[model samples]
Target: MKRTTFSLLVVDDDEDDRMIIDDAFLEIGYAGQVKKFMNGKMLFDYLEQIDPSFYPSLIVLDNTLPKMGAEDILTLLKESPAYQSIPVVVYTTSLSPSRQEKLLQKGVYACYQKGEVMEKVIELAKQLRELAESNSPKE
Candidate 1:
């Protein structure tokens, strides 16, 4: 299999969750950068400051954030052509089918329930890796 280097942005308020995600990715041997933000506001601030070419290959967003929630961020991203192409995957602990449908309608790449087990997290990391690799620009 070909290896691709890409950047992933994670927006979640929970410190433990972020650390777990980082560990999971590391355990999976993902050869990429993972930039994490505490909330959507921080994410937007980073986005504004970075060059467009350096935008993250994927954004893993938690539905419940401190300042701005995932729904609001999704709206803003969809409205802006410059950031619309970046795929966003919503990771949340409580998501109803209706909520998932709504998120999908709003243009999220995928919505996954936050898992309790380490194996589940690793699986999510692997899935995210595949999604990021598929969306990454070809050389």
Candidate 2:
């Protein structure tokens, strides 16, 4: 099957993690854009500036951030009519079961623990690529 190109927005405080994710996608030869933000504020700012038609196909959010945590960012996205339909996947180093449930209840598409190995991250990148392609506009 042919794959459709799409854009993904990732918000994570850790620069190394972001680089790893980007590299993983590249390793898979994902034919889409991967934009990274350091925090929720930067993500929101970019969102605000983009045309609605140009909005990202998916958003990957880190559960913990220096300012404006994942929950806050998720709430805002869910509340916004323009952003509500975009899928959000939460990535975290560690999460309690209750917290994961809470994030799901708030409308995140999925929650995944950060992988310890590069291979694991590559697997995650593949999943993310599939999701982005699935969400892409049908031609």
Candidate 3:
């Protein structure tokens, strides 16, 4: 099966989830890069350093990242022009309506529920592929 190329960045402190995403991508033959960051701050800092042209096609932000403050990151990204253009997707098990609203208000592309299993990770990769394809500029 042919797969769409997508550069995805996952922000979550959990090592297992990171590995799960890595494994799921490999299983589905997603050859594009999947960069993992332990927190929002690191991701923000890295994005600052790298050229915006190198931005990931999708960003998966886990709600549980500590110290880096997920909500704050969302708000900040929403305010910045360059960061605001990149699609942000919240990937966390929490399904609170308020949080979801907050993320939407901040302009998230979509949100997914994460859990102990790798099923969510695999599903997310599939969805992200669709997102990348849909958002691609027409020739």
User: Which candidate wins on lDDT?
Assistant: 2
- Spell out the clash pairs found in candidate 1: none
Model 3 Cα shift for residue 77 (angstroms) = 1.3
Tens-place lDDT digits, model 3, residues 12-94 = 89898778877887777773567788988788888898766666767778887788666777778879889777777888877
- C-alpha lDDT of candidate 1 relative to the true structure: 0.87
Clashes of 3: 0
Q: Candidate 2 at residue 124, lDDT?
A: 96
How accurate locally, in lDDT, is each candidate?
0.87, 0.89, 0.75
For model 2, how does the per-residue alpha-carbon lDDT over 60-136 read when each residue is reduced to its tens digit?
99999987999999999999999999999998999999999999999999999899999999999999888977886
Question: What is the clash count for each candidate, in the order shown?
Answer: 0, 0, 0
- Listed per candidate, the RMSD to the true structure in angstroms reads 3.8, 3.8, 4.3
lDDT of 1 by residue, 37-79 (tens): 8988888898998778777789999999866899999999989
Residue 13 local lDDT, model 1: 96
Give the Cα-based TM-score of candidate 2 against the true structure. 0.92
Who wins the TM-score comparison? 2
Alpha-carbon runs more than 4 Å astray in model 1: 1-6
Which scores higher on lDDT, 2 or 3?
Answer: 2
In terms of TM-score, which candidate is stronger, 2 or 3?
Answer: 2
Q: Give residue 35's error in model 3 in angstroms.
A: 0.6
